[model samples]
Target: MIQPDLVELVALRGAAHDIALHARKPVLARLQGAHRSAQRGRGLEFEEVRLYTPGDDARNIDWRVTARRGQAHTKLFREERERPVWIVADLHVGLYFGSRLQLKSALLLRAAAILAWVATMDGDRLGAVISDANNQVSIFPPRSREAGVLPVLEGLVQAQPKQPGEESFNNLNKLLTTLKPLLQPGSLVLVLSDFSALDDNSETLLANISLHNDIRLIGLVDPLEYTGLPDGSYRAGLPGRLWWLDGNRTRRLWQEKWAARKKYVDDMANRLNLPVIRLDTANPVTEALPQLLREPSWQI
Candidate 1:
């Protein structure tokens, strides 16, 4: 993968392009904000209510109404009018190889940078988790300050793939377990992965999270990663191997098997209500940036 600084620069440029030209029409739905007015309790429209937990903001309390009702009524407004996005990036070793201009992981970093920039630019808090294992997770609690994006970028740049045996036995599930407590209603989660390691339990965890947060998938790939050499002929330095997969387990080179797995992943994303932003390892991220910035399927 390219260095983090390079990916960060590319992302900043892409985000600027989207913000300047795309405006409210960015291809990514999570960049868009949904309005939630302050609480007046006039009708049945959903109101945002945070339980009167310790350290709750006192200024938000509806004191006048509380005095009238003769009970403590902490005010709950509609959900925040600002956008808040959570990004989960996979640094698994599988994404480290690419047959194109950049590594698959590099492309993911660029995509994440764009997301981070857009969310922060829209005055929304941006939180991210760089998960390679249970112990290697880096979490930045949501915050709206523009400066809040730095930590996420830094984490991405600094991240390294988990060492052998250092990798989590259940990376996605472990990450989700940690994520559940931090998430609140109406959060947005963007997961960037090759979808190579997802299992049944991990899928369920993701589905559960989607009930409260908008979850989208950015599935990364390289042409050579899927379709083996054309004409079924072998050549030196053809490309990297898919060691973690089944067909490739026999130390054989084959693209057909990789294609089958890729198709399965695409189908799974569709079934999970996760929209995919496909990335070609050989192409410039700018080529795909415009499509990614387009309206999402749900928006359509």
Candidate 2:
């Protein structure tokens, strides 16, 4: 049987569903950044009129239509534009394993797939920088239509962890440092990772990237990492070293480590004011991601 740890292209392609994420107009993406487009005037063509929502621009309110309708309406516009969305899937060696339904790597890639689908469906371009163990990095430049999304999906499947967890040589700091230059000011970036090893250096790199682009951190979490093992003795260790997780007493220490990891993410998000979507391996990310994206709770 094919384990859920493996990335399935067929399943990913099918994961694309009609995701309507609009406040008033059909936005290419709901992930808004600080970099606003400079060009204005005749370039903006009128698209339609729709009922005003909380986030809709007050300047766009149609006063004439508002009086007749008894409720506020806003004008929506369609400009000759598309957003560039970049996804960084960190399938480092550490994310290879899961005691739940899917591996952390698999869940991360699935979130990547859904974001690619959602962005492309709304007429945005897609690109990616996918990293794996052994220092393999697959970089795809932004492209529209299937040209943009297919290559990313293929790259994600290729980089999916082949086995259980192990020490990783992949460096997120170096990757983000190198990636910061390539990102356009207004680009939407999704970074999918477990991020258990992020330190002060890594946090600085991410903060620099967030300064220009709209970044969403998608955290890949497996239930076992926080829950620990059932009440039983288990042998666990690295390739050359071995240790035993014997009882509930030892398991508390295991769970405490995960708690620390959680706090690290929370602190980073709070400091950077970045939106975070935690995708658990136990839950189907394909379902959870869409709802998470649509919620106002994650809006910064």
Candidate 3:
């Protein structure tokens, strides 16, 4: 596999042409704003808190106020052209396994690169949280795309384990817990992970964050993980720590675990009412991401 370094990220610039920031259609757009939208839905800026009305998104409801005043209220937002975009880059261990095409780590790196390009080109502020092996680094400074995004790209490559299963086990719950305090109410967070280490705490954290911010889950998946291995001896797992899946029992067990993982993610997303974008490791992330962002539901 080609190294997921700065050069690779730079090459992904062409993949995000149609990726536009979600903006509230401002009555008067700023002279030097990001992208502005004439059509309106749930854009970025927090406009005001008003009584919950029909057709209002319940996700934006302020639960604390509702409890105190014994009346439902909603947080309203006008789109901020230069919205803050946060990417949760999961470079934890166990991501180096990919049977076909590139590994999960590469897919994530490319996806993050594409997103950074889209945000920077459109003038949206870009930040990132990169996690690996029980540690995480947050890039939350205001910077030009070159200044801010380059570090994130570098972090993505550096945080990943030298090889898969190298003991880099950063739990999703831990990462999200740390990330909660850093995010603003109207920020957009794209959690790019395989959901391999999610727990009940992770679900709670995700729900809590989504209450005040727009959260999207992007699951990086590999076909081999879900499908049982074909009839033949095949080496799998990390380099220097390889294992063979020549037996039917092992493949079956792997398939079962993967199915459960997929189910849990789906159930969690449904419970939280969050949008999820699942990208196959077999496909080109550059090509797929642009198409995914254009979908109406993903316009956010």
Candidate 4:
């Protein structure tokens, strides 16, 4: 398996550009055309016809439909354009663990890079919010394809896990709160994380963001996380302070906690009408991303 590095992350742009152009049309179409407004505009796509009201524009009258119905009707047009796309990546310590191909942190960065490249290729503005365990940084949406993606890739290259004495665990809620102001309606928001840092406040922020934007949560999980540890003695925890996982008791308890955590995230996502994609550390992102982009929602 290829370890994620700055070079690999940057190289994703070319692959993503290709995928966006050919394979992801279903998802891209949905993301680009999801927002529809009833307000009359100069947009070229006709949406629907409605009964003419007193304030309705006379020029928009659908003469053919009006003659058939024997009543005045006005045509509505849809706004045809691409929406902004933002990626939020969590690089907390919890994501530093993996039993397979790459660390969750590495996977997160790779995934974000691909999404950013895809967004740019689709003619959508691109932006990102990244937390490096100690600090959070954001790149405002930029229309230039390369300009929109380079900063995010640079941020991933510089990211590091929080040291023992660094600022307390990065508050995902606070990060989202700060990001709220920059989000625009109908935007596509992708959150990549292990979701070990979620809380009530984070849920609330996600709910609010989903009200006006299309939000998808991408969960990164290691095989050890989804499946319980094998029954055997193993060292766990920080360096020089490890504990033994000697029996089924510890493994079962860990599994139970993981299940609970998974349930919480799933419930919250469902309540907020958010779609979730779970990827394992063992799978290459190139294999997983196409499926995500070809989801049925995008075909609509």
Best by lDDT: 3
In the range 1-300, model 4's lDDT, one tens digit per residue, is 344667888888765744551223356555666333411222365789999999988999999999999999999986656567778877775676678988777788888888888888777778777777666665555455788788778877677453322334555666688779887776777888888778888988998887777787889999888677787888777777778886576777888899999999999988887778888889888888767767754321
Relative to the true structure, candidate 1 reaches a TM of 0.71
> Candidate 2: where is the Cα deviation over 4 Å?
1-7, 10-14, 20-80, 297-300
Local accuracy of candidate 3 as per-residue lDDT tens digits, 190-263: 89999887878888899888887788889999887788777788876555778876857678888888888899
Clashes of each: 4, 0, 2, 0
Error of 1 at 161 (Å): 4.0
Runs in model 3 lying further than 4 Å from the true structure: 23-81, 133-138, 142-144, 166-169, 234-244
lDDT of 2 by residue, 1-300 (tens): 133422464456566665622233334433442113531211355899999999999999999999999999999986536667788878788887777777777777777877887778767778888887755777888888889988888887778768655566445765676678878666777888888768888888888887777787888888788888888888887666788777677778988888988998899888998778788888887778878877774432
| Candidate 3 clashes between residue pairs 3 or more apart in a chain or in different chains | 24-79, 47-77
Better of 1 and 4 by lDDT: 4
User: In model 4, which runs have C-alpha deviations exceeding 4 angstroms?
Assistant: 1-3, 17-80, 160-170, 298-300
State every prediction's TM-score relative to the real structure. 0.71, 0.77, 0.77, 0.76
Q: Which stretches of candidate 1 lie over 4 Å from their true place?
A: 10-14, 19-79, 133-135, 162-169, 230-253, 298-300
TM-score pick, better of 1 and 3: 3
Which is the better candidate, 1 or 2, if ranked by lDDT?
Answer: 2
- In candidate 3, what residue range of length 10 has the lowest lDDT sum? 34-43
Sort by lDDT, best first: 3, 2, 4, 1
Model 2 scores a TM of 0.77
